[model samples]
Target: MHYALNVYGADINPLAVLISRVRTARKVEFAIGAIGASVVKRARADRRFGIETTLANRDKWFRLEVLTELSKLRRAIRSCEELWARRFLWVTLAETVRLTSNDRTSTYKLHARPKHEIDGRNVSPIDVFSDLVSRNADSFAFFRKKLRDANAVSHARYRASTDIALVDNRESKKCWADVAPFDLMMTSPPYGDNQTTVTYGQHSYLPLNWIDLADIDPKVDTELLRTTQEIDRRSLGGRDPVSNEEEERLFAASTTLKNFAEALPDTPSDGHIRLVRFYRDFQASLEAMIGQMRQNSYMIWTVGNRNIAGKQVPTDTVLSELMEHAKCSTVTMLTRRIHHKRMPDRNASSATMREEKILLLRKR
Candidate 1:
């Protein structure tokens, strides 16, 4: 068996780069799976790219098969798009509301909706659903025609065709863990043990119910397990410690949490210790991520500081120190005055925070 090396030379086409990267990513995944070992821990211990080599010989065949299947899946998603988009509208709106309360913060009173309201403009859930549902109809025929016309100038087939490479690893930690070193790492780490900024489980329920997106069962990811542990404080509407309620509606389990906490003598009485534990846990995860990165890789982390007991715990500053301690070189710290779309409403007396400090760290 022979393999063709994908290289972008001086006569480069943008599409070629995308297709080549997609193909390379797929081959890498097959290689990792074929290794039959924990690639992550192994990668940390020893940088190995052999699995990628073994799969490259059959890369072309695999790419063609996967793309054909993806085209069909895309068609199916388009077929039921109307209902899919409509249902996604609520889910998208719910996503705008960041569910922040941990199981320990649950209360019996009406939960105050955060002040942050999201603007759903042109690509609203309704529009997405409508376009998807009417894929076969002539309604979007003009748009489709225009798209095809715009894409026709290229002589590239594989170059112009972009693909998503999904590798199924039974021992992966996060959703995109197997995805090799990305050119850019832009993401927000989980905030504390509370689900306040957004309950990953709750916000995703709408998308899961309506859209035909890939299997993103949060339960499948071990990183999400930490979230489940945070929300598993008390049983809802029952005396038992466990309840069979879905994770998305775990906020409704707040009342049950307050009851459980009130019953405990060492529940910190003021909720300060919980913050400590949460931040500490977050720092640990960040360290693990640092360990996984290639040397000199950049990490963009966006986090905010909230008022707790009238003392501002500058998580950004604390995290900076932690990152440096973890051997991550401190790059420029960028402070942006962006509003937390889910910033909670504060009383006249409570201290309010309205900005996030973006930290850029480089792994050494």
Candidate 2:
């Protein structure tokens, strides 16, 4: 699918996505085979990176071809100045790779390396690269449109161009150091761990595997790619919280989460742990955001009630408690019907996010 560049305004940073890849322990591999040490060194030195030779579940030749094609494309684009915009374009190519890969099956997530597979009709890497080049201008065009709008606003309001700052926010708990306080802070935190809800890590795995980390942003640490799920795990609730007493106290702070946890129907221990893990980190991140905002500044949270252990987790109510705990008062809570939203339909925990809630809060 094409990006939401001109439509719903999905406003994603490819660097963040790529940086998430870097944050993981997973490193990109070159096409499988003994290209030996020199190629590996070259792959690292050059931004036109390689793929994991150990990567399984795809046509070997096809993977190599894509890698080769990608190398040439990177060299061809070396003269381009629109780094971020071009990274998005490369992401489009990465998407094409996913859509063309044998992994493009009926699975709910892309990480499932299928078993007992056979070759079928697939687009060659060259063909995909050709198609990508034709539409490359569109990527730059979208960025240029945004640039013009930004410049126009600056000229009218301030009589000069404005500087853009790209901060690395892959870490939720860590404080942004020496930052000026904000008049407003608006964000939509994840409903749950990406695993049970969305396979965001898996979605980026392929793209990250193919694109050069340097091409996207040199700051994008490939160390994040230690594992396919590293970013997801690094996310809220991705890990075990502190002491049990602390977890219990934090968990008990939100009656909504506590009640939801209590209502869990015949769940496994991991399911219960996952729920706790999410809200604890969610709580921590919320607290950090509040600390960054000016007193009396407004904050808005648009959250979804994701199903966990077959129970609906009232994220809005939970967040209201969190905001109150963090010295913010909930001004209002509203619900909006979700006529359109993407989710794993077959996923038992997430098949029921048919609506979302909007929570407005004022920092006291």
Which regions of candidate 2 fall more than 4 Å away from where they truly are?
1-67, 78-88, 105-108, 111-118, 129-136, 139-143, 146-179
TM-score of each: 0.44, 0.73
Q: Model 1: per-residue lDDT, tens digit, 207-231? A: 2222222222212322222322222
Predicted structure 2, TM vs. truth? 0.73
lDDT scores of the candidates, listed in order = 0.36, 0.58
Candidate maximizing TM-score? 2
